[model samples]
Target: MKAVLAIVLCAFSAVGCGTRTSSEMKNIYKEDQDGVRRRDAKAEEMRYALSFGGCTYSLIAQNYAITAAHCSEESGALGTSGAAMAAGQKEAKDVQLDSLIESGLGSDYKIYKIKWTSKKYMKAQHIWTKFALKKSAVKLSIKPAKGDAVSTVGFPYDGEGQAIVSTGFLKKVSNYIVDPYSEIEGSGLYFNAGITGGNSGGPLFRASDETLLGLTVSGDTPSYYSPNRPESSWSADENDVWNIATPIWVVHEKSQAFRSIVQGGTP
Candidate 1:
């Protein structure tokens, strides 16, 4: 009976030989309008997985993008900012910023300052550094409710250059105590969504409405499976893992500084 059970488990398992191919696995992850699934076509477009440093970021406005400050090199945000001004490049090389702010989350959580005048100016300014300027941005959710379904998009290390998505519940909404060394302000949200090293700065979204909830900063590592180990021996407590995010309202509060960029008032 034990052998039979093992065979049954192996047949149902996603990994291993003779299991579903990558294409088949993709089909199983199809996103539906009902929002039960986390992946969304629109959400994917808003997210830009940064390659310079391991981090994910999203466009909040035509010209503005936000990310975890730690993702920027400890030396400084300009550590990677050295691309010569060029025209017609699909991506801006060595993209620098007009302004970069900590956004009250210490010097590590940075908000890239962009003033978009025209496509020509955006290129001249090297606005496409990490990702080309997306046409639109994600709709920010000022206040997210506890227990709300949530999803996150990131460029996890396993995904190589591809963006990966994970869904879970909003476990809590509380103040994020900032480290004295970091020096930050404001409350943040806590969720059970999966996050990895490269997921830092990724956007979390309310699954039902697809509105932006917050940006992923950190999470507890979950367990993994080994081929030599039996299925019954696999030990992982999904319930225990939780992730932290900086709320969108905090970003909104600081919008006064970049209002003209998003409002089309000035570049």
Candidate 2:
């Protein structure tokens, strides 16, 4: 199962993302009339998987993408939904980001602070850093208004009808009933949306100017594989559609901390 999934993922990475031109890469992920999905300046903010346990991440800053470190570490596997390919199929020389970073060989890592590399995820297995490009910080230092409309940009299966930018409203912002840092396997952001596999680590964005609200961490707004009969609270026909995300404020907080460590300021 793992091996086959890996191959499928490889095929996807090669076909969809590999062929994307610089312009297309910037534009392909936008919203349709339904307002179900969201968009940043770029498209499909995170690289995503098409199956369960799949995780996604996005390029939040220059070279750094904000994601649950645990999500990044856990779903960071190269297993495809997937193809039997590695995180990045091409040799390092073929990738523009890595090459540019190395071209300035003698320079410090901070020189190309905004560049990204697939190897960041490849280095960790059992994790799917499915690349979704989000344009927000990862943490929520500032509180959000409850009624604000939010957007999500992910590779959700078109079957559920929400493609790319899935739209939803911020219902609340209270002390979470459960601790967010509980465990790597269970830590995930929840919200209201008909999201799917490829949506992992996707960005939860704001409606206007597409400011980022959070990152899609995980959840089955409606689970179909359960064994219970359709007589329970969750009937087979009536699915639970909602949205969950790692607040962008959280992402920014982490980034500021890292930036401070590297560049040294009150980031």
Candidate 3:
């Protein structure tokens, strides 16, 4: 599998170290708060965004959370595993994964169970419960159409673990084949939302009602060209680059376990 540039922070540079300095990252988030573009996500929005194993996840149920399938061990996206922490929390909690259900590499959605074990888990659970009391776990929406307004909420690597929100309109919807020789296909929701490393697996929501729409998958690299070419033939505009996401509907269609959990049944 090609290393997911959107999930590995070190991939931004050649030597495996991040390209942005800590101070620069902080400043970038600060400037993004102006609302013209991606900004610091609000408290309510951050409530659903969870930083898990270097990726982002959102609770679909009290015990079940959703993220990009590539982040899972079965997918070999990142291969590294770590504890999970809710936004605003200082310490990350070690929650046992009761199960890690994936639709497949093509679809890219992972729904996992958080075992109610550690004190950290209890703490995070309390927060989720309180939040859910007001607004139930984000409801899934019908397949979105082109020009539909959307927003992505996640912990971008440059945000220093703070949840950031980027708003944009859907550009297109199509099937993305991960392997041409196999039947594996992904339902791709393309948009221009600003996303980067550590944003993988975060929730993409309908801008109007905040319903679940998709999961952040990857974004266009800054430059690309044929190896034979001396100069870059194409370069992505940093201000207006397209990003890929996995529509939530794909998970609903492909994973019976996910459907069962979402419908209030055991997986």
Best of the candidates, lDDT: 3
**Predicted candidate 3 versus true structure: per-residue lDDT over 39-103, tens digit per residue:** 77775566556665467777767667777765643322221112233434545444445666654
Candidate 1 lDDT score at position 67 = 70
Regions of model 3 farther than 4 Å from truth: 1-17, 21-36, 72-87, 92-96, 103-105, 117-146, 177-184, 220-240
Tell me the RMSD of model 3 versus the true structure. Answer: 7.4
Q: Per-residue lDDT for 95-143 in model 1, tens only?
A: 3344664454332246665443234433322122221112123332223
Give per-residue CA lDDT, model 2, range 1-267, as digits (tens): 121122224223434323323222111112222233333213222232112223334443333333322232221222221111233321221111221111111110111122223344422222222222232222222222234556665444332212244554554333231222331122223444434444555566554645656655444323233425331334211213344555544443334443342343322
Backbone clashes, candidate 2: 58
Alpha carbon deviation, residue 128, candidate 1 (Å): 16
Superposition TM-score, candidate 3 onto the true structure: 0.67
Q: Model 3 — which ten-residue stretch has the worst lDDT? A: 126-135
The local distance difference test score of model 2 is 0.34
Q: Deviation in angstroms for 89 in model 3? A: 2.3
Worst 10 residues of 1 by lDDT: 79-88
